[model samples]
Target: MVGRTLTAVAKLSTVPAWVRRPLPAVAGVEDFLLRLYRRTESAEALAGFIALSWLGGEAADGPLLWAAPPEERFARAFLAVADALAEGESYPPPEWWRAEAGCLAPMTEAQWNERAGSWPERFYAHGVVCALGWVLGVFDDPAIMAPLHCGDGRSVGYGPREEWRVRLRACAVPLHLRNEEIAEWLRSGAGSQSGPAAVGAARATPSRSTG
Candidate 1:
């Protein structure tokens, strides 16, 4: 299992270049944000983190645009869904949050409302499940998961509270490495190692493609 983790560590750098807008992190302001990222290591939160990193990555990358494939850019669309949910609104902005354009087909207002009893959980579930599709597409890239380990608030991936976190104690790859590990690894000097440099370096690379 240690072998799997080290391998995943190296591949974090090579995902199709993802692009995202900065995510809002006002404490308590984005409660569902925590649930979505933490509920399960379900790749939905993983999706959020990747998208948010792109936001930071773009900030660092600056006006110089690197063309990423449409698949990698799914983070942008997912962010819009998150932004809408955070704001407690149902209608994600048409421009950035087209559900059909993302991992799942668009949920009709009725279907969306049917599941959501005015509570955000249903919508959150829908969005996360959809986002998972995107994350799954890049599931092979450690870059998608590596940012979760970053301590830099500017780039820290959002999903820290996932189920895999618990598995860390079991010495499982936990795929969901968190900030604390980043610190511990740093102290141990093991943190200096990055994701493995190979395609599909994930603990369990999903064979399914987004298309």
Candidate 2:
């Protein structure tokens, strides 16, 4: 494990080139990338991090552009999903929708209720799941790279949350590595910027259960 991590750390310099935008000077961001890169043994996670970081850097980026503080909304939602997955729980739980409602200030329960029932946030949440699933090999289907259709009324294609939770546990990347990657992402400030890189439309069918 140490050797693999060292190998990943060794290639850290080259990661910047693949990212569409610059990573912020957030504390521990580099360390987070290093750990994620090491455990995943790929630069994809780093690239995703870079892409997702744009949410906090500017408001004009991705689907949440209308979000008052796109970064905060993205970060909160992403962490909710990541942490839930880490603990083997279903994501986008009812509580998550109503969580930190104050971020949008002046937002009442009724407003949160309306927003929570909306689709954009759900798209963001599923997008995070898809990105994580792809990188982790749980959604290793060839169609993963296809363009994502955010509000097209198409299904996520993933079978069920519990099913994937089992697959996540059985994946080549251990549960601890998953936890560590998320922890590092949050600690590095990248997570605070936003959660997992919402790559594109994740339509890949779930890979069969490994357990």
Question: What TM-score would every model get versus the actual structure?
Answer: 0.28, 0.27
Return the TM-score for candidate 1, rounded to 2 decimals. 0.28
lDDT of 2 by residue, 92-146 (tens): 4445556733242233455434434544434333444444334333455313322
Off by over 4 Å in 2: 1-56, 60-78, 81-107, 119-121, 128-150, 156-211
- lDDT to native, each model: 0.34, 0.37
Model 1 per-residue lDDT tens digits across residues 1-211? 0011110111122233332211222111122323434444323333333333333333232111122333544444444444344345565344433443454345466654443443334333333433333334433222222223221123334454333333222222232445567668679865444445333355456778789
- Model 1 scores worst on lDDT over the 10 consecutive residues at 1-10
